[model samples]
Target: MQVAPRRTGEWWISPAIPAVANAALASLWAFTAFGGWGEQAFCGVDSAHDPTCATGFENAVLSSLAVVIPAVVIMVSALVLRRVRHYPDRLGMMLTAAAFLWVGAEGIVFLGGYLAQPS
Candidate 1:
């Protein structure tokens, strides 16, 4: 029985969606970018030397939540916001903001790579 906030009457989105989206974007970029589950993950790492599951792991993308964790967080947060916006608990909103900021910061930091669009 929770009601969503009305739009600004100019835009089509709630504005919060973008932050959550950015969180997902950042997470995808971080978790699966560069060499996350790179060639090493699929085919192999070296032809001359076989990967031992410990040597080149250092080169893999480092996310505390592995791969799917961040995505789950973003999705769950979105659902929670849609359902609990009317609740008095501010923790959900705070988490959404924090996730957005984390992603935005990562985007800014790696702007030279992922941020660059193919022109």
Candidate 2:
């Protein structure tokens, strides 16, 4: 028995599509963070009436981690897709892309709301 050749299109489909999709998501994140959307306060009183307060140092560290963790996952997945030969990479790529977009959107919404709040 002989192994069949992988389709030419498969080479382009798995890695290329996800790369473009994730890049777009990254750009959106940049825009949200720096496009005069709002100042992102990682640690502060959520509201005047709130009984709890987040220490600035702790919030900053945790918030940074929240962003970093997903970013690391995205980067790792992209690297994996580049080297994977036998498995279909589409599912992993799509899932990572979705996560990228979701995180970006959450950041945008969080900052947008913060800016919208009345001073």
Choose the strongest candidate by lDDT: 2
Q: Mark the regions of model 1 whose C-alpha exceeds 4 Å error after superposition.
A: 1-13, 19-63, 66-74, 81-83, 86-95, 98-119
Off by over 4 Å in 2: 1-13, 39-65, 80-91, 94-116
Residue pair clashes in candidate 2: none
**1-119: candidate 2 lDDT, tens digit per residue:** 22334696443344445555666765655454445222334323435422122232233334545664576575666556645423545544554665565565556446544544445
Local distance difference test values of all predictions, in order: 0.45, 0.48
Could you give candidate 1's per-residue lDDT for residues 29-119 as a string of tens digits?
5554443443234324456333433233333334323433554565466557655544434434544555655565444434323222223
Clash pairs for candidate 1: none
Model 2 is weakest, by summed lDDT over 10 consecutive residues, at: 49-58
Model 1 TM-score, all chains together = 0.33
